[model samples]
Target: MATYKKRGYKPKKEKVVEEAIEETFDESQSDVAKAFDGLDEAANKSEQWIEKNSRPLFYGLVAIAGLILAYLLYTKFIAEPTEIEASNELAYPRTFFDQAETAAGVKADSLYTLGLEGGDGKYGFLDIASTFSGTKAGNIANYYAGISYLKMKNYKEAIEYLSKFSSDDELLGPTALGAIGDAFADINQPKDALDYYEKAANKQANDFTTPLFLFKAGQTAMQLNEFSKAESLFTQIKDNYATTQIGRNIDKYINSAKYAQ
Candidate 1:
């Protein structure tokens, strides 16, 4: 069995309050902003009008400021408190996983299973994912559960959990895609695996992950007897990533693909 490994699973810092509230900019309020658009005209044309409307403008600015402050207060007081509580609940499984993994052997896999399905008064990642889907902690649980399934060689369940995992992170996003490729490959679905490998390579376009997935994609192409595509993907690593581990060993695969062609 080809086992999948993931980057260290840690609680991703949540910036949801800032990011979520950004969408609340209120396009409907554009009408109010338009009133001040001709401030140049205000400066030159209408001292009397300015004096007459000054009080209302003051009230409008004050009202907008109030709305912003109120939102910040709500996020700080209400949303973040719930976030902290959820994180606290998840800490047990997360810590147990780390300890078991470091111990190595069957214990690690058993702990991963335990973390997915809790017992002994400990909550599992699945519990956190289901009960607190709106929180940042819940999102992290989905990733944990998916990787555990991949390690267990349960491909269908791996796909199910990994498909739901999403992140804009430079590493995790590509990693999730690559893990999906590994799952597909294990099930003799090389074509689907190749697609995900290509997607993972392109997801973040960086040194560490991109070349890794490109290498995996090249291997998958060879499995599908796609010699020409395999040659291209292999040559890409040789040309661009000569210092990477895969790049250093790329010549053997490229030569094989060429010979097959």
Candidate 2:
């Protein structure tokens, strides 16, 4: 038996493998090309949309800029100048108010009247409070007017002006509240007096106003026959404000409230 060999024979398996690798490379190239085409289409759409809305975008930006400019102009020209003018106007009334605090009886009353009503072509606290309503000096005018009314024994007007005044100041805020309490007490409203005294005490925790108002609140509570509340307030003074003059003398008040209870 004999076997015959054919010359120049090539394997078809290697050719099939080479053809598959070429096909895979072509498919990868096609995918990359499709991705680039998609990106280009998206960019063209974005540019078209921006072009269509460009006028509206520009107008919106311009409107925003206009508002900012208006605010700046108003703050610089109108508001700042008004504030300065209001402050200058407040000085005249303030002098009368300060002098009234130290003067006696008729002299004090005359100064207070001058402070409230104005003289020598200058504005008074009442006018400043009304005319410059939103200014800092105007706010201070309200406080001055309220105290003037209180000193003049005009309890109703005192309550009105003091109630209108608002502040977050450590000293002034509590003092205003305490002054309201004083007005209420003078008008024979012990309950309202106690309430405002409590408010004043809790408005801000400081050495001067806190113990002062707390002592007043305790006394007012005693007047209303709220002995337990009075005792509690006195106890707070003892615990927190022992260095204060009122706090040093708080024990007697505490004992009185407890005994009453």
Candidate 3:
């Protein structure tokens, strides 16, 4: 009994368990390495894309910044200054006109002429209108010019200046339209007068100017021998605008229109 017994084979369960543990450890290491490699590849692709497209993106950003800067400069420096200048320039003409309203005969006419033509080298309504056609003061100049020309009995000039004037002013807008109709009537263009008179009546729908224009329209329609149209206009004054100055005397015109019809 001198020699040690020879070693025997291990149990099957123990051998299988040890081999599975070794295999699992090896596979886990391989999966981790593959995941790290994928991450490195994605990072490289992102860097390449950024490098390729960076120039255009930078240029686009610069363009947007420049546009914003230019807009700010124009608004502050050019647009605002021009608007202020236009407003200031209107004072000379407006003052001359105010004085002309109270002046009598030759002096009144002279003041109006000065307002239209400018005095002492100062700008007049006509000059302002031509210089600052896009501004509020310039637009008002056209209205003033129109009325001045109307008072001067220059019907063509009245039409020219009035047609150029535009505003949302509640009183002036209707007045300009009615004045145009008056010019047409003075020129013996009854059809044109009637059309503009009707426009004035409907434009702002106020008590004062509406009845006045309606009266003018009725008169123009009668001049055109359109008795039916005249009758309707007078009836409108009687029914809806019976309190105005024109409405007070509207009954006779209504009766006249009815007789003509």
lDDT of 2: 0.95
Cα RMSD to native, each candidate? 27.7, 4.9, 10.0
Candidate with more favorable, higher TM-score: 2 or 3? 2
User: TM-score-based ranking, best first?
Assistant: 2, 3, 1
- For each candidate in the order shown, give its overall lDDT on alpha carbons: 0.86, 0.95, 0.90
The candidate with the higher TM-score, 1 or 3, is 3
lDDT of 3 by residue, 169-234 (tens): 777998998899989989999899899999888888888988989998998898889999999999
In angstroms, how far off is 133's CA in candidate 1? 1.0
Looking at model 1, which ten-residue stretch has the lowest summed lDDT?
Answer: 9-18
- The per-prediction tally of clashing pairs is 0, 0, 0
Query: Which regions in candidate 2 have their CA more than 4 angstroms from the true location?
Result: 1-49
lDDT of predicted model 3:
0.90
Task: Compare the candidates by lDDT and give the number of the best one.
Answer: 2
A best-first ranking of the candidates according to their lDDT comes to 2, 3, 1
TM-score of each: 0.70, 0.83, 0.74
